[model samples]
Each structure stands twice: as structure tokens, then as C-alpha cells.
Target: MSAFLAPIHSWLFNKVLLFQDIEMDLRNKYLEIYGEEAREIIEETKNYGELIDRTKSIEELIDLSNIHGWLQNKIQNGESRVAVILSIFIDKYGSDALKTAEDIFYNNGIKQGQMAKEKENPQNAKDIFSTLNNYILEGMPCDRVQKLIQADEHIVRWINTSCVHRGNFERANADINLFYKLRFLYLKGFVSSANEEYKFFETNNEDDYIYNIEKA
Candidate 1:
């Protein structure tokens, strides 16, 4: 009886250990595949929620302004891939990633401008603008940066004719006012440091935005 019981016990113990090992491997593989997908979903979902809230708050402004119908529709569409990328960065590196990236771009722009100022033959406005542009491009993926540049051109156009949007913006209580102010301040700082006045004007050509630099 003792011999029979010993064999039975040994078989049961080995099977239990094998089952545990299989379970552990399955858990690890599941995490390996699903973990990244889970994180992406979380960030995308959060960005969607934030964008929806922002759109809701600014709906009145959108309705009142001279903004293009396509732009209004786009904003209302709630399909901001930039927001998702930003959210991923924030999740992995913490919210401070935003400030850090901004500082990198801003400080480099200032440094380039200052270096130009110190030289007897300072860099021209076009060169300075290129430096600032490169700084921004360095911190983002190329495709995303291209999209940003296009959006920025639109924003510059809007601000150049700000009379169209100012009243609606003022009444809507939107945070875009901060962006409007910051653009002027940023350009002003570049102009001051580089010892140049860069003037942007609309043109009749296909690529309508052009800038002229003058001695300060």
C-alpha cells in the first residue's frame, strides 16, 4: 500500500508543477502582445475625451467666426492624431515632457538668435527662421512636423487677419487667445535678438505666405 501511494503522489506533484509553468508562460506572452496596445488605447481615448470637451466649449466661437467650413468640420471631427502622440509622450515621460520639449525649442531659438546678434555679420532673417524651424523639426517626427507647419501657416494667416476672429474669440472664452498672444511674442523676441524685422504678408500665388526681412 505504501509503495502504490508513493508513485501516485509523485505523478500528481510533477503534473502540478508543469501546469504552473505553462500558466506563467501564457501570462508573459499575453502581456508581451497586449501591454503596448493597452497603453496606446488609453492615451488615444484620453485625447479624444479632451478634444471633445474643448470642441464643446468653443462651439459658439466656431459658429460665429469666419473660419473655413472645412476647418470647423475638422475640429468637430475629433480626430487629432497630434493629441494622441502628445499623450503617448506624456504617459511615458510624464507631463513634464511638454515643458521640456518647449524649452528645448525656445531656448535653441533664442540661442541661435543671440549668436547672430553677437556677430559683426549677423545671420540674415531667413537663416534665423531656418534655425528656428529646424529646432522644431528636430523634436518631432517628420510627418507630424509637416502637419504642424501647415497648421501654423493657417494660424499665421488667421492672425494676420485677426479682425475676422478676434470678436468671436473674445466672446467664446477659448484658450486659443493664449496661442494668439504667444505667436506675436515669439516673433517679437526673434526679431529683437536677431536685429531684424520680419514681416509676413499674403500673396496671390499658390503658396500665399511670404515674409520680408528689413534692417532694424
Candidate 2:
């Protein structure tokens, strides 16, 4: 919203678009990185023109919107267990979680997957974000489910890296199934820690969906 934040937001918006316009080797990288739903969506549209047409119909439009939100939800699910572990760290070790996060990501054996594919091409950025936006405001976007085996390589790597750096064996053996819930905030644009306490109160949107971020 503010001028300073706008650039970073715009950059991320475009970065997400990179996912939509993905093609060739780059697209394959995304397919590998995102796994099932992203692969299905990529297979369905292949190009920006196809995605645009697919999004034109009202019914189709909602389905597309769900793709982005659902993807984020999926990611949030993926990272949930890691988050819970982090929370326990916070509880037991206080603010040491921040240091832990840095150490985990900043070391060797922590593989760096190819992120340059999208960053090199701006058009790809636009495409990914457009599809991501289309999916955010609608129903479930991607029905594709990623196989546990498909996502495990990167998962195991990160988990091990964290474990080795923290000197904590439990981190290496942490559950993977529960971690997929972590949202893809690059597309969603908000990074909320699971530590943020949430208190629930009932609400009726009539349509039976929840959208409001802040509840009073």
C-alpha cells in the first residue's frame, strides 16, 4: 500500500506471475518444485493465452481462484509440523526460533533449488501471478494432489539441514505429512507465523465462506 512496500509487493506479484508463464526447462523446474496441483495446472494451460480463456467463464473463474488459495493452503499444510516444532522451540527456548530458522537455511547440504528460472524472465512472472490472482478469489483452484514421494526429497533435505545445524535430532525426524499445510505466501503475499494466536468467534457470510483477515 505504501510506496516503499509497493516495490517489494510488485516484485513478489511479478515473481508469482513467473509461476504462471512457466515453460521449457523453467516450467519443468516449477513442475518439480510445486509437484501435483501446479503440474496439473501447468499441463492444462501450457501458455498464457490458454489460461486467460480458461478463466473467462464465471464458473471456471472461481475454480481458477481456488488454485492459488488452495495452493497456499496446501503449502501451509506442508509446513504445519515444522511450524509446530518451531512453536515448541519458542516455548522452550523463547526467541531462539529466529536464530534457528536462519541457521537451518544458511548452511551446506541445504540445497538451493533453481529460483533463477523465473527471475530471469519477467513475462513468466506476469503469467504465474495472473493465474494465482484468478484462483485466489474463487473456489478450489487445483484439485491435483502431490504424492508424498514426489515432495520428499526437498523436504528431507531441509529437515536434515535444520537438524544438523540445531544439534537437535528431533528436527531431522519431524513429520512431513503435517508440514504441507504451510501456505505459499509468495502468491498470497502475507507471511503469518503459526505463533500468532488466533481466537475464534462465529460469523455468517451467508455464502458459507470465511474471508475477513481481522476479526473484532
Candidate 3:
């Protein structure tokens, strides 16, 4: 690997492993709750983790936007029982599961931000926003954020109209409040890691947000 790309490759590999760990944790939790039924669903869902592990290039990882579709098809059409079993798991364990993933992503972002600062190349708004967005994508299967070029360059606005996380929550009948809380935690983590003063807002639509990077 080239010198400039080694760290990124390492990071991606570690992320794949982290994804697997989270999957295993969720599988165990589901097994504890639902026994054999959960096992079958987990077995069927193992491909999700395998796809991450088999991703050999960053571009391949970035192209993994179809995860939500795969999940939906699996749950809705693969087996009738899977929908109920998976819903139960999500309703009961979704918050905790998502929080765990967020913590992993957040800590990694903090470490990367610190590294950049120590190198005397403090990240800018674009860089920070990109990193935050990437962390979200890494932690979950979702569409990429749509960056808007606002008149104020210091602020970054983005829209995510299709959130697989939200879809999952809705499908599982999970509390929407928990999804909001997770979003807050993710944004807060990004701000702290970037070490920037900023104002953030989530829209009533629940899928859009703005980040004012350089707060006066």
C-alpha cells in the first residue's frame, strides 16, 4: 500500500472487524431472546457481515448502498417468520445496538482528528463534515449525505432523505424517539471530535440537518 493510503486501509479493515463484532453481539442478544428462530434469521443475515469483510477496496465499500434493499427483501420476502422475529429484536435492542456502533465510530473519529491536529494540519469544515458523514455510513447502511453549497461557507447543510436506520426503526416498530437520540449522539460526537464550535439542528422532517461549523 502507498504511504498515504496505509492508514485508510488499516482503518477500513478495522471497521470491517468492528462491524462483525457488533453483528455477533446482536446475534447473541437475539438468540438469548428468541432462541432458534433468531438463530435462523441471524444465519440468513450473515451475508451482511461477510460483504463488509470481503470488501477489498474503499470504492467497493462506498458502493455498498444496497444493504437496505437486501435487508428489506430478506425480512419481507425470504421468510414470513423472519419479519416478526427481526422486528422484535429491533424493537427491544435497536437503540442499544445502534449506540454501540455509534460509540465505535465516534471514538475512531476522535482519534483521527487528534492525529490530524498533532500533525499541525487541523481539519476544516469540509474535512470534518466528510469524516462525520463517512462515520455514519460506515456504522450503518445508508445513502450518502447530499451536501449543499450554501452562501455561507462556514456552515454545512446536508439532507438525508433516505435513512435506512429510520426505515429499520419504522419496520421494527421501534421508538422513533430513540432514533432521534441516536442522531443527537452522533452529531455531538462529531463536534467534540472535530473540536469545533458549531450549532446543529435537525429538521422536523427528521432526515435533514445543518451544521454551522465556525460559530461566531
Candidate 4:
């Protein structure tokens, strides 16, 4: 059973589902705001990827013969869909769309963070970071998007080895810097709820991105 679809496979699938859920929530919000206009906005942004059948488990839905590629495709699909939606919204409605999207990401992050804290009882910065990773979509583990630089009981630091979302954003014609801004909101919300005494910060070090989680 482990060979066909391991725990990490299921873990990544759940992350994909989380992104889908967030995207749908953003879509529904637009639907309510724009009424019939949203249909066309969403339609114009279509074909980035297909949504999965929510009723089925990953084991039931995955292509067993090409498990890695299948999961990778879904991850890319999810990333592309998000970038397109955000891009389209910003182009059509400007700051209004951006504000709504920002709220959705931050609220979802807080929700995930609180759930992680309640379920895992994370005691320190490292524990909080581990639990947060379970919810955020950072591509497959093999991508090595982040590498741990240092860690102690009170602090855990990592450097971005690569970015998985950049290509999708570029393909969608979205502002990559805006994506990071929205993502920062999500992280801020997550850390605030995940642990009140801890904070998450992003810094630049000679063209590299550094992420730090430590006690406040």
C-alpha cells in the first residue's frame, strides 16, 4: 500500500484540495459581488486546469501507474488556476479584487493555523513550523523549495532554494511580487493564530529569500 501511494502522496493531495477550496471560495465571493459578470470573468480565465472530484480519496482518484507525475500535474494545475483567477480579478477590478483576495487568503490561513494548533498542540517555533507545512502547498517534497538553515527550540530558519509558484504566475501574466504580498498576509495570519508568542518574517540576503520563525 505504501509503494503505490504513500503518506506524502496523501499529504500533498490534501494540500492541493486546500488550494482548490480557497480558489472556489474566492470565486463564490466574486459571484456574489459581480452577479452575472463573474461568470464571464471566470469563463475568460478557464482552461488553466481541471478540478478534481472531491468525493473520492486520492487513492481512488490517482493514476496508480504514474503517481508522482499525476500528483505533480495536479499541483501545477492548482497553482495555475490560482494565478489566473488572481490575475484576471486584478485586471478587471483593480484594488477591490485584490483586497477581497487578500482577505480570503489571510482568513483561510488563520483557519488552517488554528486547526493545526488545536490538533497538534505545537509547543514551540519548530513544532509550529512543522504543523504549518502540513497545510501550505509548497510543491512535492522533492522540489526542495526550502532548506533549513538553522534551528533551536525558540527559532527555526530556512532559505528558499527555489520557487514552485513563480512559473505559474508568469504563465498567468500575474505580478509575482503581488503573489508574495498576499502570501505574506497568509503567513502572518497563520503564525499569529498558530502561536501568539512566535512570529514569521521574510528577509533578503544577496538575492536569496530567508524565512524565519522565532519567539516574539
Candidate 5:
């Protein structure tokens, strides 16, 4: 099953031995799980995309329990491919519901590393975190940090719990996207809010465990 689904990990997202065998081979795999007639119907389907949509809906056809566990697992293994799939899924579903940031956004995300490099900071993310942590530590920068509290679009959704979400702590790529959004807080509030200095980052620490949608 893993091998059969391997192509899906690619941005190409699918693989086939031959044009004629494309539907047949995939159907054969599905048959092993869903039965012969289902396989036949899939093979006969006119549109490969329609068949794919249907196949995804069948719990018996696709082992979602396993898939769900591995849904965001691509970063640790096939990062580029996983990011591709994540981007596709987010494009279709919209990022409004996902609190942190999904793999899709991460696959093609902002380059904090590049930005930090441009800013001459070797550790931009770490620097941003330290700044915020210091703000908490000193208690002298409440207004300064508050100006930095530009919540991400998914921040509210992440806390809602009813929403499906993703972010950096979830995956490296997603983290970048979240950071990109959080960085905006500085743009929106920092320079304008108070007479203080706080480095800008793409994301803020939401006072929760790492990747906790409850606090994103």
C-alpha cells in the first residue's frame, strides 16, 4: 500500500506503469481493499479525478486511520513531496479553517532564513523568540509585545479546536508560514504602537504547548 501510494507523496502525486494500465493498476490495488466490483467500477470511470474523489471518500478503500496519523508526517520523511500535497489540500479546502499553517503553505512559504540573512541575523527565529521571551521576562515591554501580537488568520481557529489546523511545530514548512503571518504584527502595530524596540517575526508565541492549536 505504501509503495502504491508513494507517488502521491510526489508533487506529481501519482504514478502509473503505462497510460493504458494507469486505471487498471490503481484499481487492482483498490480491489485488494475494496473488492473486485468496486475496482471494476473505478477502472471504468471516465474521469480519473472523479474516481479519485470517490475512492478517497471510501473508508474501506483508503485506510484513513493510518493516513491521518501520517497526514502531516511527510516533513520528517518526504518533505518536498509532502509540502506539495499539503499545498494542494489547502488550496482546495482554504486555510481559514487550519489554525497554524498547513503543509501546503509551508511547501512554498516565506524565507525567514533569507530574511534573517538579509537582516544580518544568523538566528532569526531564535532571535524573534528570545525577544518575545524577554518581553515576558522583563514585563517592561507589554505594550511593545502587545503591538507585536498580530494574530494569525488561523489563530482563532486553532484555539476553537473544532477546526482542522497545522503550523510549524506541526511541520517545519508550516512553521515558516505561521512565522510569516506573525511577522506582520510588527508591520501592523510595532513601529506605530509605542516608543520601544522589538524585533519582528512571522509568528508569536501563543502561550500553549508547541503546535497546540488550542493556543495558536
Candidate 6:
């Protein structure tokens, strides 16, 4: 945190920015539907933290002396905002709002997948899995939110060692399962768009969810 930003710092920062971007998209849609009523929740979200200036590099905006804490705060702030916005809309609009949120996640995932393909040209399930991690904001790299269960030419399997979104969603009175479902839409979109041969899936595993990327 001393003006010595590593690749991981910028990586985490980018994921946070992506998360915020989705929040902004939700805000815009809220305004379109609820108009003035959306103002209250929109302002409430701003109270969490100032949005990051995405055009600028993380190096220019992050707190040099508290890099880890700063990135962690971004994740918390973005997740809380997302949870609040989606929860309110879900309460008001029910399945309709959920549909819009799903579309946002899925379409954004496709864009990210396409971008990752351009950069990495991922040729296998494991490659797609790695690229998915690059875009997913799971926690700090040290937190190790994901654990690889297996990997080979045909597939890659993993489980969540920890969840960084549950607390935020719970505090906002949102369903954590819904959040995971939406994220899976994003991942499904990502894998398909990243490589037509790859597909993504998730299933219940007692307390933790198991995720897979495999040949279609």
C-alpha cells in the first residue's frame, strides 16, 4: 500500500468497478420505472461511499497507505448498494425486476467474456474458469473465496470456500440465494460467450454451492 501496487491490486479494483457499473445500471433502470421515487434509494446508496472514477487507473485513486482496506471497502460499498437497489425493486416489481437484473448480469457477463476471449483466447474449460475468476469480485486474493476441486481438459470444478456477498445482502434484507442465482447467470453467459464449447453450472452442496465449467 505504499505506491507499490501489484497486478492483483489492479485486478481486484477492476472487479469492484465492474460491480459498481452493474449497480449504476440498476439505478438507471430504477429511475426509468419509478422516476422520482427512485431518488430516495439512489441517494441512500451514495451514502455508502463515493463511486470510483473508472476512467482513471486504480493507482491514481486508491489510498496508497491502505490499499487492502480500500479495496475491501469498495467491495462492501458496491455489494450493499446492489443489495439495496435490487431488493427494493424486487419488493416493488417482483419477478419483473428480477428479470431486468438477470438480464443486466447476463449481458454484462457476455461483454466481459468476449473481452477476456480477445485478450486470452481461452481454449479450454480451465482457461474459461481462470478468466471468470479475473472478473468475479469474490474477495481479496488472500481470502481465497474459491477452492478448485478438479480440473482437466473437459471440465473444471470448484466450491466456494467463503462468501463475501452474503453479509451485505443479509444486511440489506435481500435474498442471498437470489444473488447467487443472478451471479450464476453472469457466469453462464460468460462461459458460453467465452467459448461455445464450455458451459457453466451450479448445485446445492449442503452449506456451500458447487460450481462447474464443462464441455457442452
The lDDT per prediction is 0.35, 0.28, 0.46, 0.84, 0.29, 0.85
Question: What would the per-residue lDDT of candidate 4 be over residues 83-169, giving only the tens digit for each residue?
Answer: 888888888899999999999999988887888889887889889888888889887888878889988879999887878888878
Winner on lDDT between 3 and 4 is 4
Assess candidate 5 and give its lDDT.
0.29
Model 5: colliding residue pairs: 86-104, 87-104, 101-166, 168-175, 179-202, 179-203, 182-202, 183-201, 183-202
| RMSD in Å for all candidates | 24.4, 19.0, 8.2, 1.7, 19.9, 1.6
Per-residue lDDT tens digits for candidate 5, residues 12-45, read 2221111112223333444554465444444323
Superposed on all Cα atoms, model 2 deviates from the true structure by an RMSD in Å of 19.0
Worst 10 residues of 3 by lDDT: 74-83
Q: Candidate 3 — which residues are off by over 4 angstroms?
A: 1-122, 138-145, 149-153, 168-177, 196-216
Instruction: Count clashing pairs, candidate 5.
Output: 9
Residues 135-187, candidate 3: write the lDDT tens digits: 33322232333545442436666554444454444554445455455445545
List where candidate 2 sits over 4 angstroms from the true fold. Answer: 1-77, 102-120, 123-216
User: In model 3, how many backbone clashes occur?
Assistant: 0
Quote the RMSD, in angstroms, for model 1.
24.4
TM-score of each: 0.28, 0.23, 0.46, 0.93, 0.18, 0.94
**Best candidate, lDDT:** 6
In angstroms, the error of model 2 at 29 is 25
**Which runs in model 4 stand beyond 4 Å of their true positions?**
1-3
Local accuracy of candidate 6 as per-residue lDDT tens digits, 59-116: 7898888888988888988898888888888888789888999999998888888988
| TM-score of model number 2 | 0.23
Tens digits of lDDT, candidate 2, 99-203? 443333222101111132223221222232222332221212232221112122111100111111121113334333222111222212320111112111213
The 10-residue segment of model 5 with minimum total lDDT is 134-143
Residue-wise C-alpha lDDT for candidate 1, range 90-170, written one tens digit per residue: 455554544443443334345445655664333554454444442221111211222212223112221121122233223
